[model samples]
Target: MSITKSYSRPLDFKNGRIEMSYGAGGRAMAQLITDLFAAAFDNPYLAQGNDGALLPMATGRLVMSTDSHVVSPLFFAGGDIGCLSVHGTINDVAMMGAQPLYLSAAFILEEGFRFADLKRIVDSMAKAAFDAGVPIVTGDTKVVEQGKGDGVFITTTAVGVVRDGITLSGDRAQPGDKILLSGTIGDHGMAVLSQREGLSFDAPIVSDTAALHALVAAMLDCGASLRVLRDPTRGGLATTLNEIAKQSGVGMLLNESSIPINQPVEAACEFLGLDPLYVANEGKLVAICAAEDAERLLDVMRAHPQAKEAAMIGEVREDAHGFVQMTTKMGGRRIVDWLAGEQLPRIC
Candidate 1:
């Protein structure tokens, strides 16, 4: 008699969760992949049943990126591991001004992982990849001891085709350029925190985890003269901006009032003693363009659904100290300095 067969149907995945046998290299493991992960992320690359995906590519410089998703509480308000993994890898490639074409995912499961939950994550991943117009080609599966691994962890590798004359990098930002933010900050982190800790709000918050290539392409199409493009992931907008400022050896001065922040998110941060600047965001981006092209660029961003809240919040300038300063809403200037301590680690 099959031990699993004795269990109840419909799988009480909400509570009855992961186990070691799920990750073990055996019949159960194969069944789990075939029925769940593979089903959700299926494509010719992943369908090949191989160790790695073999793919053809264009001649231009290829953009490749890899990222791992291991957010606590695998499922959260408005998003989960499945779509997050796809968005993470795709955004990494998009940061390079590349058109992401394909993805490969690897899953690490603790022994007792629940089949029903796995199915949900895989389905979510597939929908994201498919909707983003990128297919996951190949992948790997591994099992860890019951206690050694989290419920599940996913790592994804993406390959993209970079358009000619669209080179962008953190080091490419320059003084006198206009700094534009894609949209409001801190929503993703707030949403995740609220869901994990059972907090509720009058206005529900949702993680902004999403793919950014389409938005980037739209901006590029406008010929707004982009010098640099970056997605604010871990450490949020503050960290990413600091990295660019330091890399470009310049300073950033901002009109804080111009930056957008959801009122609910701002309120939550005040309650939690968190700064909205350093909080994590998966769907937001920072763009540095010529000062003359700022308005056109903002227009391009606002035209998109994801960037309806976008705004030009700051300007890069020459500074010996390489400091990032912002004018507060109350008309006081303060250093929007780099985060001294990790806020919300494992945020991405």
Candidate 2:
């Protein structure tokens, strides 16, 4: 019997640095893909080794979402850019009351980037996808010249299937609806900012980055009375609510005291002269439902570990301008307008 020759040697992950040729679409690139990405994100669909996946779909409406991660200091207290990329896309898909099925990732790597770091990131991404039961079915990678790009940038696209008779949208909120929040806010933005600015607090504020599809599934079990669902991310709760207000053509009235915030996150925002309302949250979500179904939804949300602190923070109201108002603890009413500019840039 004749022995076949191997196309590539063992990768020197400990000491090897990424080279330009790795992205040149040759044996080197093939070796990287096979040895690293494919090995980490192993699944039946990905095992096909095709340019794209041929997915098997159930009877449902398809939902798709895409997101990019350029967060500074790729690694932070609780998570890194890798898991953030996966969780962000998963949350986006879950926001529409869909069951996420698969994911695709593309990486833009900088020349001279350490192979070990790249491996670490890929490992985290794989673990997140595996835990969420969502496989990464296809991917691509490229290297940019040194100084031309960040150490790494990741873009992810997710596809899901929504069951028949389930329709969720930003334009669905109506007057007299109740607004529910999953948990404390501002953890993600403050965590990344602290790492980037090298600021220390009384307690380490870790990012709340996590895949929220399971929690969403639990909420959907309560019934399909859910009108709007959103994961307050980049521009924070304020921006997300503003977008929903405009989309639904309704106004919102929030209770300032009802909104949850961690003590350390609150202190960090105060020290940084930031508003917790405008800070980002990775694992949390905003749910809107009819007045009668509010209690049932809250019960479902509170039962989940990720939403133990869930609260009914606001309600939808009729208004011509679609204003978002907050009732302060001091009994004063203030308009929670849209964020004037980027509150914290490069945040997921």
Candidate 3:
């Protein structure tokens, strides 16, 4: 399983730009795959060099999820699109209470994109996969003409395994269930927004993008009666809660003061006339469990580094209307509705 090396000069990464020939299925494409993608995402499955990866069969139920990342600013304060693609798909699989195993990535590169930038993104993806103990076992690359595409768009697919007797789903939520939030919200959306709009704050806001399988494993091992797990992503906590509420045919009551948000992000949302609840988040998750096991799950969640700021934010209630309501700090109640439209486009 070896790639044929070219005898000609190596790629001019510093000054060269992607050309159409790179995706023409010729020697240039082979060399690009060998020198760049395969080298960084080196693994036995990928090294096999077949049309598709040969994966081992698992005994448990399998879960698969795919995500496409098109964040406007490819590179931001804490992360770029490369790592974001990996983390986003991994989190999706983990939300099903499964152990992630492998990933497949496909990249659409603009013809004039810089080689140096592509290399940086590929390396970031490699590091993220390595740190998460998952491998990019298969992938495809294509180049689009200039002006036909953004700098790059990455689509990643993840597969995971879940043992028997451990089931989680949005419809599993029931009355008297406690809702828990992993940590602070709006960091990712605000980070991207600040960079795109050239707005600076007293303290820099960085995207909270990270793999959360480890944090999920801790909660599962604690023997808590968990019923639902969801990462509040594009629609933020408000929209995500509404989704779960509709799925389970129930309602939610949240305590405004209980939800955690970074001070800088709060300020940015205020100045920009945006509600943090509808803002996107890439690294935060929401969990629901029986009211009796709420404290136990919260203890284990707080013990994990990814969820140190975890808090019990709300509770599920029996309501045929399937509404999500919140209690503000001023002792007023209001409905937490779904996002009306695109609050921030391409924020991921």
Candidate 4:
């Protein structure tokens, strides 16, 4: 599409609302991309204005991950759907012990959505990418008829590179490996739940939504002895550990007292009749490494602000049944199974 005549007016970002034509392939669409997304996520790659970004290849193994964000309320205690979208996809790549390089975001905006709100989300996404040292190289936007879609939905795709000889996977966990958690769990789930349900606590709970690449890099700097790295997200810590157990053909034994759960989170879970073990976390990670290197890795992890609350919560064990058992504070042991059902839906 070519435009011979200059446009007369600029998009009224502060007072305007999204329109269907802004998503159609025409001057309106191009203007929206240029005035909104491009301005927010400015970079040489996105400046190309092409159908797809042309990224230069670099040495090392390539890692790519994609995630869709549908968090309700759009805004939350510590984050919104925008930054959440960036962090979620970046964490996925970081879980593989890769250094995130670039990102691409796509928006499914509902027609009549407020332009101010859209700008806020886009700006947040751009800031997240900038803070993480990654760029949104390419993106697409579409508008769905009003009431056909929610306020907005964002899908982010991230690409990263892992150095040669540095491999991490869920199946890499083995018997006698130590289990480590980056920090307290259930913060993200509870934060979102509180906002969605209008539940208030003595102290406000904030979502632990953050990118974990730097922490993963610090762990890798310690050594390649790191067996597996996973961010416990949707199903929370219990389901994540179960998955690792089944993947590595190993069972797990956890120390109930050692598993760190913030008092507020615990209280919220108790009141809500939810298990913190099964509540989702956005910023925390579960690392399984050789028993000998566990302390060493923990030292590296604790040195970072994100992992100051890191703890050796459990150990991988030899069990054909692949059960995840936790020794309770009450001097009893019980199963920590996968989340029974949807505890919190549309929680991101």
> Which candidate has the top score in lDDT?
3
- Clash pairs, candidate 3, are none
lDDT of 3 by residue, 1-348 (tens): 999954776888999999999989998998899899999999999999999999999889999999999998899889999999999999999999999999999999999999999999999999999999999999999999999989999999999999898999999999999999999999999998888855545448999999999999999999999999999999899999999999999999999999999999999999989999998888889999999999999999999999999999999999999999999999999999999988888987
Candidate 1 residue lDDT tens string, 92-120 = 99989899999988898886777677878
Q: Which residue window of length 10 is worst by lDDT in model 3?
A: 195-204
Cα lDDT, all candidates? 0.86, 0.93, 0.94, 0.93
lDDT of 4 by residue, 1-348 (tens): 996987557999889998999899898888999989999999999999888999899789999999999998788899999999999999999999899999999999999999999999999999999999999999999999999889899999999999998989999899999999999999999988888746645547899999999999999987849889999999999999999999999999999999998998898999889999999899999999999999999999899999999999999999999999999999999999988768888889
TM-score of each: 0.92, 0.97, 0.97, 0.97
Among all windows of 10 consecutive residues in model 2, the one with the lowest summed lDDT is: 195-204
Say what the RMSD of model 2 is.
1.3
Greater lDDT among 1 and 3 belongs to: 3
lDDT of 1 at 342: 81
- As for candidate 1, its clashing pairs are 18-112, 18-113, 19-111, 19-112, 19-113, 20-111, 20-112, 45-137, 46-137
Task: By lDDT, rank the candidates, best first.
Answer: 3, 2, 4, 1
Q: Return the number of clashes found in candidate 3.
A: 0
